[model samples]
Target chain A: MQKVFGRPKGLTEIPFHYCPGCTHGIIHRLIGEVLEELNIIEDTIGVAPVGCAGFSLDFFSCDFVGAAHGRAQAVATGIKRALPDRIVFTYQGDGDIAAIGTSHAIHVAARGEKITSIMVNNAIYGMTGGQMAPTTLTGQVTTTSPYGRDNGVAGFPLDLPKAIATFDGAVYVASVSVDSPKNILQAKKAIKKAFRVQQAGLGFALVSILSTCPTNWGMSPVDSLKWLQEKMIPVYQMGEIKVAEEVKGL
Target chain B: MSKVLLKGNEAIAEAAMRAGCKLFFGYPITPSTEIIEYLAKHLPEAGGTVLQAECEVAAINMCFGAAAAGARVMTASSSPGISLKQEGISYLAANELPVVIVNINRTGPGLGGLGPTQSDYFQSTRGGGHGDYRLIVLAPSKAQELYDLTMEAFDLADKYRNPVLILADGFLGQMMEPVLLKEKKEGNLPPKDWQTDGCKGRAKRKIASYFLVNELAEEACQRWQAKYDQIKEAEQRWESFYADDAEYLLVGYGTCGRIAKSVVLNARKQGMKLGLIRPITLWPFPVKAFTSHFDGIKGIVTVELNAGQMIEDVKLAVNCRVPVHLYKRQGGMLPHEREILKFVGQVFNLPVRGEA
Candidate 1:
């Protein structure tokens, strides 16, 4: 018998504490696989955000620094600037990146910081129960929006990847999903490329992953994936959003 | 190398560089803005990074990142800006990262003015941020002390794996005086085995403040308290001028301390029994300075640029052995020497000087 399948060396033995139906575990596995495949696990430093994403501090085998909510990019900026030779990345959720941390997100992209950021867009605040988030889709009901999110009152869900694509500093921007096996593989590819961009010292790179929150969405794990594929895939741009001339080579 | 004339803010920047600071993240604000400006111009030449962050909050978070990466880092701001950085500062304290923060304090309960004031004494000595944490606060009264204390702050920060704050007022920041740029001597600091640079030859490291389990959190708090206790024991610093054999003592820190020293000297020339006790470490509060010189003391007067904030600590230090009087000038106003002399004369029944 051959050992063809096992946990990635980049992940610790500690099991994840995510909700049963959550896609965070799958996303975590993808990142772990990417870190191992790149063979840069020993040379990379990661910054974890102040949400479910923050729990990554325990999962990744690479050196990690947990950042305050929405400030992961800022913290990553500090690390990368100080240790320019070491690869640095941030793991952040929609509420952590698109809400209170919005200013840091915009400025990090605008500054063309030589770092990678993975934005997991689940459209709701997961760790803090099902509350409304900036990425919450209009007409979507949440704990704070019992009457459903109204576009007139709550405004529209932010198209973060699209907005980030416009920044000249953001050399590589991709909107990926993990709703299917094929998309999961594609998400891993995009994540690896984001890290490659940093390894090359090209510029800022980001991969916004459309994720699922079954518990927060009030759906089963199976139905959550179905809803994400049906609704989210159509609303969000589904492929590489921006590839600067230099990033195109990578 | 040699004594050179420099503004307080500029001297602090130069001193930070000499102290092996490799990164500076700051936002430009009144009185303290020169610190960032000077570092932005000179730090790059020394192969250091100086970033003018979008705001104080971002700048301080950046300091958190660099410090965790084992880089000597600093950030500076004034009163309102420091308030903005409270969240990040709290995180830094919780994580026990080494960082030096400079607060060139301006008057404010809120954006009061840009003039010199020591109104931030409470915020600096007390943890400005949330949690049961403390920052070692160093108060420098003049340009020379500003340079010296800024250099020492980095060592103190690294020694304890905690944040150190240099607290000065707007007057000290803008005033020009001679500073001796002392040679840097390396302190025997513990190795940075906890830094998150990489895990190449070692196990992965995690720098986080979140302890989900209550027992783990409580243990962390106890560990930090032990470290703070050790600091309070070894780091109490103060200067006593003519305190020996004096009947009345005046107490102050930062710019007000310099003013109080002048008042003490002038009072002594007038044959009045006056003295000064200047606290250099405001957080440790230099209780030892008071108890050691308490004999034959009648009363203590606190001179400040705010509404008697440090007087509370002064009262605690003396333990109500003598009455503590407060002579303050608030809202960016400086306490005139003559007014302090008159107030002290009235309080202790001393003879009023000719100038008064």
Candidate 2:
């Protein structure tokens, strides 16, 4: 109770505009905490994709560049390449990253740019009003998939962290959820690892956090996090999928 | 200070290095790919940035990112690719960012042939992107000029706080010639204090075009137009040849200028009173010269690779002082020298040039 409850300095003093009990605030805090702890707030540059979190430029104290729709990976790659001495990362949502920007994310990793990515996997698109996200489970119901997503109709939900872990250019890959306090701690650790890996000059670190959207999911904050745990985690396991340090060869 | 037999592509690359261009974002397109490939191999070795972006849109956006960080960044593409990059170009212009772009034009309405052409003259010179904006466009004829123009391009871009286009043709990209690279010759044009280097100790700098209100955006556009007006006073450059006592003025830019140059020399040898007004900066369009030529010149013959883009501008500049004839050839190949001379002959109605 005495410690571990401090706020991140990387975030601005202004309150977030997200809805109450929305996990975006929690995830943003986790990333901000990592940036603050690493003392990278002043020099760290973030590429904010076009989504709900895309407005993060106004919230984060660090230098942030807003990318065009679904093009944050490419922007981050350019920013990191030009300012290789600084820490560069991107904050993207599932629709922004795994759906429209799948090619950019894959190619950015494949190119092995020394950058980190924080992909928020909320099974529905929040900013655009609860559309079926690329990570939407097969039987998930959203505004777009009102009858529950049929695999035959909408294709299978993409397992992003697992799919990205297979790429050889990725240095570290992990999936974490914000459903429980224990998982939040683990999520903090994963975000830290991504920043640390980028600091080490390793290539393309990604920490995919399973997030919640109360406003769009049409549920109370409690039910959304609970739904993510009961429904989303079975499709996306919350653990590290690939670790570069564990590989045998130098 | 390197003296190398460099092509236009290599010259721009070498000159960029001399100007401290450590970051390059480009997508591979014909004629312009050498600039991308050259940077790809060199930037990494020199502790710089080289990203072969996924598409022209992504590539220019990458340049936007790098330039936002105060990096001397550049991108190169052909006509069609430049079309794809138009939106980002407008954004960069709106944000008043310093970046260099090279368009090695091939014939194009769409995916036009890979052959060299000056068809993109209007695309590069005029505001191809949607905006009340202007880019300092340098049209280089020779490989050595490519080097000279590129070094100047960064300065012009920084001076205007805008993107500068090094508009070259495919022939210039491929043809080799001796180039003399310079170091810091522009005499410290300016430091990039306008860029966002995280604004460490200073007030945070915002690099964006987003405005919530239409009125605010319109005000920004007006401010941008003022910058353009100031740019015209400072950045207009052209090369005048045989302007003193010429009867006909042959006007062109990029590769067409070179062909027109040879034609000028040949016509001079034949004692035909012809002069070449080659616009080195295609954007400002040598309006002064275009207006001045009306006093004595019989006609202004405009040649281009495209159907008739720059000719319209030439006609506007002439303002009906003289007949502005459009001598255009589309497709990849250069207009036949004989065919052009025949048109020249018809202009004077003199013996029709070798039975044409």
Which candidate gets the maximum TM-score versus the true structure?
Answer: 1
lDDT of 1 by residue, B188-300 (tens): 99999899999999999999989889999999999999999999999999999999988999998988899998899889889888999999999888999988999989999
Estimated TM-score per prediction?
A: 0.99, 0.91
Error of 1 at A80 (Å): 0.6
Return the TM-score for chain B, candidate 2: 0.94
lDDT of 1 at A57: 90
Badly placed stretches (over 4 Å) of model 2 are A1-7, A139-148, A246-250, B1-3, B40-49, B54-58, B129-132, B269-271, B347-356
Weakest 10 consecutive residues, lDDT, candidate 1 chain A? A229-238
Instruction: Please give the lDDT score for candidate 1.
Output: 0.92
Report the number of clashing residue pairs per model: 0, 0
lDDT of each residue in A58-142, candidate 2, tens digit only: 7788877777777778777777777788888889999999988888888877877788999999888888788998888998889
Each candidate's fnat, in order? Answer: 0.80, 0.37
DockQ of each: 0.87, 0.45
Q: Model 1: what is its DockQ? A: 0.87
Alpha-carbon runs more than 4 Å astray in model 1: none
Per-residue CA lDDT of model 2 for B76-165, tens digit only, reads 888889998897888788878888999988887877787877777777777789867778888999998999889888878877788999
